[model samples]
Target: MSSKKSDSEKITIVIVGGGIGGLALLNALSTSIDPEKHTVVLVDARPSHMHLISALRLVVSDADDLLNKAVHPYGNHTFRNKFAGNGSFVHGSVTSVKFGDDGKGGELILDNGEIVAYDVLVLATGSSWPRPLGFPTESRSAIEEHIMARRAEFSAAKDILLVGGGSLGLELAGELKDIFPSKPVSIIHRERLLLNDTYPDKYRIAVQKAVEDRGVTVLLGDAITASNSSDVSTSQVPEGGFVTEQGKKLNPDLVVPTWGNRPNTSYLPSDLLSSTGHVKILPTFQLPAYPNVFAFGDIIDWKEQKGAAKAAFFHTPKVAKNVMVYLDLSERASTCDLMASRRSAKYTGCMEMIMITNGKSRGLGYFNILWGIIVGSWLITLLKAKTLMIGRIPSQTGFTPK
Candidate 1:
């Protein structure tokens, strides 16, 4: 919708769930969406900037003073609002979508029974990955940031077990092993080999060699299921079994759920998606038969990726274009492929950087790009992650982190 319009007739675009994908889309859509012609409603059940996790490659000079939190600890609300700008971050769960004919209009029902009507709906409700907070993106930015720092605390520990030999687990375990060779690292996986679907033998070979060379023990192909039956639906607990199909138990100090995510699609109206709960998208990137409705990021299962794999929120321009097209701005809709972008991400998660802890003198780096499954060093564990951004998100009634 164009910015020029009467306030009363302005079309509303309702976005569900504020994660990497939702927030990124909101950031991109603000300029393109005319506030007069369209109102964007972004909903998530968390305090503003609550679940955005970050690891600073280098600490902000005055972050401690401005955020009122230690440089190593997570910042408070005062910090998050700065990150979100003036974006509308709601802290409420979307119950369901009120389905309508064609793709023109519908209502989104929240758990509070609050009904919101939208000219177009974008299901940017990303998936929930299993982690300490259940959903990796479900905690406050400060809290999750602190968790990354928590890994720093382990730099001096003597022995550690890294489970779930997939990319996440392997990268984390191997990185830690590389960064802290003083500590013995042991990896446990349910499968005989790291998931075959994720990589060819070469990458796995690289990961294995890197980790093993670093004195990390790689336990390949152990089948394990959820130890507890009730945990099957919740995101907090692992499937539970740490045993191989042969019944060998691989124990570790901490086990991270590396991959696997349940999409946030169930929050939409049942009729809005197929039985599987994924919004079926047409080739043009619009939700099947729904014009005002579109999807991107972890929600659309176009590729059979776990939520973690599809968590990149970089594909915002194309999604925004489709929204504009639905508003009658263009004769034809745009496509949501990465190839068209002038600047693009490599789209893989494994970079070799040094890790540091206990005030930066200590360091480790992975010679290989893949997590140090095989040939990593202790330096890989402490410093191989994120660079923080500049900003804070203000406190809002609905923008609470879950």
Candidate 2:
């Protein structure tokens, strides 16, 4: 097949973006057809998402799953053995895609400056965020450098300013105060609540008390206008939000923006995607517009919540199986439609997300069921640490995590 041709030929499916959903899709692809039955290439727009996911993870599970879902661009042999046993990973971004242009059907215009032919395309590029608000760095070296800088800032500063009041600010302040005990760490939020007022009101109030009890100062409804943009990225528009109706500086030693994540699909066209920014798919998890294409995980804005509590590989086994079935035989659904079961959904955002602070021993978990809540368990913390220390992707496809 050449770069562009307009007719149906032997299906060569090319998956773009190797994040959690992408990897699961690829892993699903691994067992779907024979080794060489379909041509496949997993494309990552960035060099990797390891640091990006890990930093956000500290605020989420802060545990074993981060490394399991991370990607190694340079190609670690052990990591390769663990994850990419059969899949061929290519390092390049899809600059443009031409449909039905190639003899086979379509082809991806990659940044490496090559034409990648495919009959079907699946995109699962997740979103991105910034420091303290999101992952701190892109690579291991950058993270190490950041750790050194933060440690220096920790040692020298009398006051540490936590700029945002979301989970990042809450977790960082609580952990830092716990570690230093006497050092002043103040958390500032532009609004009144710590977490949004959406959950049980008691949840936010209790968390605020817990954070305050840790000796972290909480300042709410205060806006910080920068003295100036001393350092701003050239490509980025004077990107900032604190110069309020009246100018004032709620100067904290640091300012981090954590609320800048949406479904990551800018690389994809607007038509194939739904308003929520995830790819629109039919009930079977196959792209109705493009049946051969399949997607799930963070990219599918389904009835399930994006977090692991709901869409864990264990919960959506049938969605995965259904995709497999549809791929092998046309228009056939799997025996079980687990995706349609929501009455006993048992998976919701209220499901506990075990968020650990920098203090390894201490943690917080948001649980839907009261019985599932626990904190400061050394055994559980130890298990999480071990898994992240060595990257371990879960073998299961999609299930609600218990």
Candidate 3:
């Protein structure tokens, strides 16, 4: 299918990826952008928005319908109804995108041979995670099938070994122990501490304490042997038990590597990206070469740690404001008034604040302030652990969590 604007004067805004960053921008444009002057199209591979904040909880959860809450279908009236007549949500994986020779507009081709033309393009495609946390970029049913199978593995496994001491590894270990209390859960990390040096040592110790309090074993300053771990599909655990670099042998029924991630920039052009595959953008979030192009979320080469909170709060507003400013500059023949109203909308970065839920009831929080402020479990549970902020989906993206 192709996108055809009813009026030639209307600007076509094509946004790629329906993750947090994409949805936030969609909400901004759908509500404020002039329907008569511009059209919006959001393209995504999946049929629904996968809220992965609570993904660890879902895997260990006995609740069958928790998956429903995690994945909100695009067919929901709350999401589709919000769009103006010209705005829409298209489901397909973008194979490639090319801006027009004039650099004013461009067109992208999907895997299914559909072409989508746009006056302005936004690349919000986030990172690709492991199974359970991430699903196949196919239909909603396919994703559900994959998750259900992974859940079965979690249920049947006698013991689980998680590689990496990152936030996700810690959370997964906590969730497993929480649900299956008797099950042996262990985490192996290359670093001596539970997390990286990004946070204070005090905060990292607190995080380790929180995980250990739940009887989860953590082995620090160690890594899986190269013979066992491979470069391809790190998420795919080794078949049998493996030996650590320190020569410690482990035999867990399920092995999950929770380390390393790559941005979903394979479909993007190399010129617009850094050496690491992250999109290169100016402070305005627009591509330096393609002024009509913008990128956000995990795909952008930003200094901040990639998370839903940063994408929703910081990147969304800046891109939304700048997109409109660009549109006004494009539509108006006069430049003086538009230039006066223009704000570059710079994202300077925010305080390093982390709220990690160990289980349904216990967790840890930290804010990188003066020295550091370590919040208690009660606050963490109250804010994130209880529901993982799933209830806020409707208000944030106009889609009910279910």
Cα lDDT computed for each candidate against the true fold: 0.49, 0.51, 0.79
Q: Which stretches of candidate 2 lie over 4 Å from their true place?
A: 1-11, 47-86, 99-105, 132-158, 174-182, 221-249, 274-276, 303-305, 308-319, 330-358, 370-402
lDDT of 3 at 374: 93
Give the alpha carbon lDDT tens digit for every residue of 198-245 in model 3: 888988998998888888899999998877776213444555567789
lDDT digits (tens) for residues 1-402 of candidate 2: 655322233355576765555655555555555443444566666455443324433333324444334434433221222233434456676777666522224777876797877666665656554544233323555544554454555556565666557665665665566457797777667777776543445556666777787777777776444443332111112344335424543434444443335676665678878887887776655655565555655677565435432333642554556544544553233223343333112223234354434344444445556644434435434644223323344342221223
Please estimate how well model 3 matches the true structure, expressed as its whole-model Cα lDDT.
0.79
Q: Model 3 TM-score?
A: 0.92
Clashes of each: 61, 21, 0
TM-score on alpha carbons, each prediction: 0.64, 0.67, 0.92
The most accurate candidate by lDDT is 3
Off by over 4 Å in 1: 1-6, 50-87, 133-163, 174-185, 225-243, 251-256, 269-277, 304-314, 329-402
Best of the two (2, 3) by TM-score: 3
Model 1: lDDT of residue 182: 68
Per-residue error at 198 for model 2, in Å? 4.6
